[model samples]
Target: MARKVIESVTCDACSKKGLEVPGTVNLTVMGDRYDLCDEHGARFRDQLAAALAPAVDAALSA
Candidate 1:
């Protein structure tokens, strides 16, 4: 068996990151791709949900 060496991966949000890709999420938005750490990814998702909440409520009411 042989081990392969790969480049170091860092959390897009972590300082002096020890984590790497294949571990982080690859999120694509508006034709742009971004690699984000777990915390950032969850934050983004929360923000998106919050931003859309008003619209969602309006649509539901209508």
Candidate 2:
């Protein structure tokens, strides 16, 4: 078996970065494969959610 590599991406929220621990997700979000570290993931998710809400709402409305 091949060893799995955990890819890390810079946090989208604070931009205060950390090493990305490995995990699984249904789809990659905001160009990152997994959530950011505790310092920024929450803020990143919130910002992403807010930024995407209008688009999502429009899609849903349509």
Candidate 3:
């Protein structure tokens, strides 16, 4: 018989229960791992992209 390992994770932004599946996005920022649900993960991704857009544009222009 084989044993299964389950990893329980919760969303860092909203503290909501996460799906805890292979497709879940686990983000490590500043040496801390944050688990996020689909909604919060999307929001975080969008915000991060928006924040980095200016720097990316500046670097490209330079």
Candidate 4:
């Protein structure tokens, strides 16, 4: 049995296209989950970190 994906979003970091397919990072918010590719997932995480707080920007180099 396989779990169905809820939604698919493009990688905000890389322009690569992705689908709501399996084998990807999943994040559930408000009873909904978004599927992101590996590269984009990292980017999404970074964006989320930055959005959550300001410390993320200070941790960046240059």
What's the best-to-worst order under lDDT?
Answer: 3, 1, 4, 2
How close is each model in CA RMSD to the real structure? 4.1, 6.3, 3.7, 8.2
Candidate 4 residue pairs that clash: none
Q: What is the Å distance of residue 8 in model 3 from its true position?
A: 1.9
lDDT of 1 by residue, 1-62 (tens): 99999876555655446544332766677998767777778888799899999999999999
| Candidates sorted on TM-score, descending | 3, 1, 4, 2
Residue-level lDDT of model 4, residues 1-62, one tens digit each, is: 99998764553323334333343666667997766668667777887877966665566743
**Model 4 misses residue 59 by how many Å?**
18
TM-score of every candidate: 0.59, 0.45, 0.69, 0.47
Compared with the true structure, what per-residue lDDT tens digits does model 3 show for residues 3-45? 9999766666665343343335777889998877777778889
Top lDDT hit: 3
Q: After superposition, how far is residue 19 of candidate 2 from its true place, in Å?
A: 11
**Model 2, span 1-62: residue lDDT tens:** 89999865543433434444432222365785644455455556688899999999999999
RMSD of 2: 6.3
Comparing candidate 2 with candidate 4, which one achieves the higher lDDT?
4
Clashing pairs in 3: none
